[model samples]
Target: MKCSAPLALASATRGRPREFDPDQALAAALQVFWRRGYESASMAELTEAMGITKPSLYACFGNKEALFKKALDLYERDKLKYIGTALEAKTAHEVAERLLNCALATHCGASDPQGCLGVISMVGCTAEAESIRADVVARRASSEAAVVRRFEQAKADGDLPESVCPTKLASCLMTVLQGLSVKAQGGAKREDLQGAIDTFLTMWPRR
Candidate 1:
């Protein structure tokens, strides 16, 4: 839960110039919402956190909800970009491994110790988190579908045993990855998450 300090709030006033720094304000707002859910985050707290006045906060990001959404979007764009690249892997196995491994690696702080913004920061925010959750759900579905497609190809190519079920295997793998995300957020180590993945991979159909 070690968070960076909030940045300053800057918004263009009267179209003259950005009176304050928008990035810092948005980042400060992000910390506010990240620590406290959108419903729980207060205007007083956000203004204090952003080092700005009430009207200025509203002027920059509209309302609290818009500000929260903007912060969430920034998080998704910056931290969740790993997912986009992983989806382009040659096989579903590769895709799933790359997706979860990269996530766990970064999330566990092998690179940075902040756990994960996607899974960790949004834990209790079902209402305000719908869009972000939908993003995760959609990504999981698309990734699993890709896995299923690759499994089908593998079966056709005689890489998997005839008993393999693409749909079932994909579902199982997705479940494993979901578990990994939660575990990583809960302070699981890279080796621990990798072990879980290895166990799941062993469940794959063998020729």
Candidate 2:
């Protein structure tokens, strides 16, 4: 269920009436959690970044874990879907390109550029970070499985040779994408990544 935006909650104080745009608020919350992690992300930072009050923050989203889940949902819905959707392409090569360029734009794209939420979340806060970290891990596994399934389909369709192992190739593609994402977060150029993409394309099994 969607809630009101932080904008609406920002205007009015606690106990008073205020309209909020849930999506906008959730998006802002997502950024905060993405940058700071759930434990490190405080209500002040969230409300401040969101331009809303603590009560409004609590009201809109139940608590920190809930907010984190909401943020993850948004990431899954918005960011992670890029690769899965792109893998639906007619050719396996397109699938690879789509995965790489998507990683390029997503992990390193412009405007409030933050590294991957998955990697960022996995990096710090060991004890308090278990649930979110687990979620990200599961999400990644699911994503890899999806890509592998696509590669298997591509082989079945004769888009690639029968001799190739789709799971292995998909694993390679996913690893390449993860590496590209790490490089991208560190300022890897689009063309450089594209060059890598081109290299992968040439190596496709064709017999």
Candidate 3:
């Protein structure tokens, strides 16, 4: 639960006159952001959720933008760790399987909030928060790029057909991935997403 924000530790040492768990506070903030998008998550709601005063939040996490960034980092590290691991899978098809399955579990799990914080966080960002939207989009692009590179490697290794375009294949998978997140957010069940993933995997490129 500990955040990467150094200010939390620094502020604690400066005699803030209140003892709060930065990790716990950050976890609370993560939930708030997951439930409400970046622009809609007001400081009042954040402070209330984190169980801290405005001053304490500022001292520990910086401004709202900075706080959201930290929260996003935590979200990726905790919730999306599988993406990196899946890239190391034995084959490109296995990589896609691992990714889609993991995504289904993560998004539809009972303990966490529904859907993807990454997908929903920037969906309707205000004009004033265009940079935030761009940031999320860039991260997503990086992820899609990784998949594309993996597919290219697969093509070279003869795991996929020469007719397959790695870039287009990666985009198709990513499109399904994002769509699954949206559907999960809208109350699609785990069984339904799993069924969809199974069907999609059958379309994975073959030699």
Candidate 4:
């Protein structure tokens, strides 16, 4: 994302005020939410990480919920780029391999915070954060639906066994993906996760 100077308020007057890059601030907020689940992330922590005051955060990004939604959008746009690529695989097995490999890279990246941000937010969510949980669930459902559709096409193209159920397969794959996130959060090694994925793929149904 490109960095641009913050937009000036129309009502601003008098001496010039400090300006911070909105894109940079949003990115910082994303890291905080990624490290700490949405509900557990404190407003002070968000502001401190974003390098902005609470008033500025509110003025630019609305409330915490709104900020989280924007951060989630950023995460999907950036971190989930491999998903689109995985959908383009020539075979169902290839698609599953790419998805699992990409997910492993993402969940266990050395420079990134461990675990999946969506998983953290959704799983750690409380009843008070029902709206946030619902939002994450809806987004996840959409992704799962895309995987299901892709698997259905694969079955139609004879890339998968006729006996395989696209919906169930999609669910199974996603369940493994989520489990990877949990394991990564629990400090599981990359080799261990890779081994598990290999085992699962080895057992994948064939035509």
Candidate 5:
């Protein structure tokens, strides 16, 4: 991966006093949401974790929902690179393996929080946060749809068997991935997730 510099904030960001590194603040906010879910994480918690006041948080990232959305964007961009790369694989099976293995490592990695922000953002969430939940659901669906499209292309290229259903396979793989995210959040070891990934790969359609 290429190294890039952190984003610099403009002067008097949105006409409010800027107090901290925007990237760092956003990252802190992401972790708060990741660890506490959407509604459970209050402005006090967000500001404390972000090392910014409420005014600064509003100026930098708008309201709570907007901040959560921005955090989700950062989470996906930084953590979900594998999904895009997996689509470029030579076969549908390779695509699934790449996605599953990457997901396992990401969810279980020591560097970041356990589980997935996408999964954590929605569990036991309230109706007040329905839009955020919907947003997370839509993003997950889009990912699964991308997998389905990749599998469709693989089938067209004869990488997959003619009798197999691309959509069904993609949904199955996505289901496993979602389950793995929950397990990882529950403190499942990396090796355990890897074992699950290995088992899932064995079920992948063969030529």
Candidate 6:
């Protein structure tokens, strides 16, 4: 099994060297940050969750801020894969639909922690966490820019009405998506969130 391979590797290298799976450790760190947010996720919690010594964490992942950044990267790469796929959709409406559905599935998944890591970090950041907040905001801006570009292309292709402003439309969609994350974090039910998405989709302009 996959679990056995890691155990075997540890056994084989026992006397020779100390080793740990970086990916597994990072995944664990991601869980901690996702659940507790960057400011609230203490070094002790991260090290304990990651199953690594504090020295090992520092050696491998740097300080808390650095580790949180790495965890954010993993979150986007693994959990937000749908964003790229949504851009490939034939219509702007289809793109929005896919994004919303994927986000709903991700936010409400039974096995994973509730809400978005990015949203949680953004909301929970304190004055001391300005750098982390800026980083999250910058990353969000990049993603929003991508969506705006997609909407521009859709408008050019007649998949979206010329009357629609791509930037504003992108902003509006992003607002709803972020709102979903906030609501989910606050214990909003899946059905209620789905209803909100349904209402928003109904109001979305057609080509």
Residue clash pairs of candidate 6: none
Q: Write the per-residue lDDT of candidate 4 for residues 154-173, one digit (tens) a residue.
A: 99999899899999999999
Over all chains combined, what TM-score does candidate 5 have? 0.89
Candidate 1 residues 91-123, lDDT tens each? 556766777777666566434233454445446
Q: Residue 46 of model 2: what lDDT?
A: 89
Who is ahead in TM-score, 2 or 6? Answer: 6
Order the candidates by lDDT, highest first — what do you get?
A: 4, 6, 3, 5, 2, 1
In candidate 4, residue 90 scores what lDDT? 95
Q: In model 1, which regions exceed 4 Å deviation?
A: 1-16, 31-45, 110-123, 126-165
Clashing pairs in 5: none
lDDT of 3 by residue, 8-33 (tens): 55353443355788778888999899
Model 3: weakest 10-residue lDDT segment is: 1-10
The runs of at least 3 residues in candidate 3 whose Cα sits more than 4 Å from the true structure, single-residue gaps closed, are: 1-14, 111-113
**Model 6: per-residue lDDT, tens digit, 48-154?**
98888998877666678877887888899999989999999999999999999899999899663378889999989976889999999999999999999999999
Q: Give per-model TM-scores.
A: 0.66, 0.81, 0.90, 0.90, 0.89, 0.89
Q: 4 or 5, which is superior by TM-score?
A: 4
Error of 4 at 24 (Å): 0.8
Give the alpha carbon lDDT tens digit for every residue of 86-160 in model 2: 978888888887877777677656654456777667665578868878888888888889888988888889888
Model 5 per-residue lDDT tens digits across residues 79-196: 9988999899998889988998888778777554377888888774666889998999999999999999999999999999989999998999898988998898887777788888
The 0-to-1 C-alpha lDDT of every candidate, in the order given, reads 0.67, 0.76, 0.85, 0.87, 0.84, 0.87
Question: Which residue window of length 10 is worst by lDDT in model 6?
Answer: 1-10
Better of 4 and 5 by lDDT: 4
**Deviation from native of the Cα of residue 1 in model 3, angstroms:** 22
